[model samples]
Target: MTQRREAAIEKTDLTPLAGAETDVAPLGRQGLKPPHELTADEDVDVTQWNRVAAMDEFKSLVAEKRKFIIPATVFFIVFYFALPVLVGYAPKLMSVKVLGVVNLAYLFALSQFFVAWIIAALYVRAAGRFDEMARNIINRLKSGRE
Candidate 1:
């Protein structure tokens, strides 16, 4: 490695964060702030909520979550990793006669966009079910009888 001539570094002036001149309107700045609104949302009790859940219940919930994650990851990995490698390494694999002009690699490249759309759709479908299941489990765990 070759060494270059060192450049001079300039020091910056450090000052207090708020400064002496500024009139800070902290949490009371309401006009600048967006309007606060509330609806039929459950107000969670922080103290009791922080209490430890049973080990078995936690374990079961984790296991169920893993069930959703693992398969989805496997599916995503196969399509995401394998497809790119297959596209790069074997572009000839996708190439074929179409209109006696165009190659299939061009077509396969376009198929990536379609595959992404399909994956997104499938993930949304799966996530909806997973979210519902998680909500049910959490509701069962919560103390409030709402």
Candidate 2:
């Protein structure tokens, strides 16, 4: 009787349908091969990965990124705030006409948008170099593992 009850409970249980079979899966290895790659293996070189993470080249790449990003951020902050500060403090200068009723303040404010776009474009270009550096590091690690 108890065996029948247990069998019925197992049959009615919905746990298998409620969740994925695997709790966790590996990253970047689920059929996401790049164009240059033919196939990916499940093997992982954890030590090599840790070594690559600690490499000086990797650190320099990060530093190079910060070098551009930090200054750009500071410059943008000051440039963005300068117009409002000038307008609030020196209203006369800000109100002066630059181009037939277009005030200097308005021109400066408008230029901010262009400046931001230029900065973004420049970062995109710079990011290419960063990507190359990271790829080189990864390639080196992969080669060393073999």
Candidate 3:
């Protein structure tokens, strides 16, 4: 390598080595605080969280969300794509005026924006119930009832 290229490569190589030396400790070496030094709740209980997640209530919450979201997504996709299909295949019908300076196709395409917003608002409202269920599950876990 040329002198400049060798110098640049050496600089980059040392950068990561310098960082790793400080970031990662050597094998079998204790970190700043040993494992036993931490309290029970100080560390997150992944197994307890996993058990809570595997509960029937959690499954039902997910199912309820999917019930609304999946259908709403499918409906929106069909509705959104139908506009271009109608415009391409039935220009005459799409040109038919329903309001002043607004053709059927224009109205339909514009309505898609409103439809998306409405669906989002509906989902947000429905999510309140899901949030309640999640809070209940979390409370049960915290209280050691689960």
User: Whose lDDT is greatest here?
Assistant: 3
Ranking by lDDT: 3, 2, 1
The candidate 3 region of ten consecutive residues with least summed lDDT is: 14-23
Residue 36, candidate 1: C-alpha displacement in angstroms: 34
lDDT (C-alpha) at residue 94 in model 1: 55
TM-score of 1: 0.47
Model 1 spans > 4 angstroms off: 1-61, 144-146
Clashing pairs in 1: none
lDDT of 2: 0.77
Tens-place lDDT digits, model 3, residues 1-146: 23454477885564432221123445787656455544344334546767877999899988998999899999999998899999999999999999987899999989989999999999899999999999988887778753
Please give the distance, in angstroms, between residue 29's alpha carbon in candidate 2 and its true position after superposition. Answer: 32
Quote the positional error of residue 16 for candidate 3 in Å: 24
Taking the tens digit of each residue's C-alpha lDDT, what string does model 2 give over 1-146?
A: 33454467776774432332233436756754443342122123335557777999999998999999999999999999998899899999999998999999889989999999999999999999999999998888778769
Off by over 4 Å in 3: 1-46
Q: What is the lDDT of candidate 1?
A: 0.57
